[model samples]
Target: MSEQSNPIRSAIAEAIADNPTILFMKGTPEQPACGFSARTVAALQALGAPFAAVDILPDPRIRQELSEISNWPTIPQLFVKGELVGGCDIITEMYESGELAEVLGVEEATKASDPNVAPEGQPVQAAPLGIENRLR
Candidate 1:
């Protein structure tokens, strides 16, 4: 089915457009199901960026539709301002280089300079708004 005709695709696209920053990952930010997702979540948390997270695990179609929409065959996809910011490796690299903060439009948390450690504080959780599962 064409993207315009698919409800899942429409929902996924809407979710991306509606949320300024969103991560479609294997699990929730608090309990990421994969190492890549964990690392990605950590990077965003460390940067103190509030984003919306959608767990793609509840339904396989979520992942399939997300990947199709993103054109990125990866579980942990980060979208900033309705654009794909890439997966774990890209995020990690950007974090270490401080580019992620620039992309996220937040100050680079001092602790985030070290990829091994998260910022010292209660890691900012994903924002509640626009965080729905986006699946029927």
Candidate 2:
């Protein structure tokens, strides 16, 4: 089936469109399944950037559809404003350079001093089949 006609691809696209900031990763932000995903989550959390997370491990198809749509064959994919921002390495670089804060619209003063300190509160999680919830 064509990507446009694929339901999973359609849902993935919709999720990207719906959430200003979203991460399609191996596991939930609170419990990342891989180091790459964990680092990505930490970067966003340190910046106190509110984002929607979709755990792609529950279904292999989720990762497949997401990678197909993103054209980024990486587990931790970060999308901002419905555009692919990149994966862990890129995110880490951006975070270090303060570019991630700019991308996420995090104020200079709000950027956490310690990258290890995750912001308080639960990150929004997108449902596997029907992703719902915007960055709050």
Candidate 3:
């Protein structure tokens, strides 16, 4: 059957179009339910960029539909400007290389560089977001 007939596909498409920067992750940005998701969230947070996130945990169909539509067999999928940027590894690499900030149209902030804070730097840490395996 064509994907157009699937409501989940439509929802995923709508979400990507609606949000300039969105993540189809395992959980919310405040509490990602996976190590990959947490890392991805942290990378984005470090960039100080805003993003919308959808948790695929409530329904297995969401992840299935997302994979079918994105043609990417992974959660923590990132979309920027309605384009799939990839998952955790890609996001981390992009963050380290400053490509993520460029994609998000934000200035890259240096670690421990906030002038308002003391000389001792406070690292931007990903919240203690738990990790859940969906591949099983």
lDDT of 2 by residue, 51-132 (tens): 8888887677778888888899988999999999989999989999989989988885677656555566745554434542
Regions more than 4 Å wrong, model 1: 1-5, 109-136
Residue 7's lDDT within candidate 2 is 65
TM-score for each candidate, following the candidate numbering: 0.83, 0.85, 0.78
Q: Each candidate: RMSD to true structure?
A: 2.8, 4.4, 7.4
- 4-111 in candidate 1: lDDT tens per residue? 577677778887898888888887777779889988888888877888888888778778888877889987999999999999999999988889999999887544
**Worst ten in a row by lDDT for model 2:** 127-136
Clashing pairs in 2: none
Q: What TM-score quantifies how close candidate 3 is to the native fold?
A: 0.78
Candidate 1 clashes between residue pairs 3 or more apart in a chain or in different chains: none
Any runs in candidate 2 off by more than 4 Å, and if so which? 2-5, 117-119, 122-136
Model 3, position 61: C-alpha lDDT score: 80
Instruction: Please name the candidate that would achieve the greatest lDDT relative to the true structure.
Output: 2
lDDT by residue (1-136, candidate 3, tens digit) is: 6545665666777778877888888877766688888888777766667677788897788789889878999989999988999898998888877888899898876432321222322233332122122222
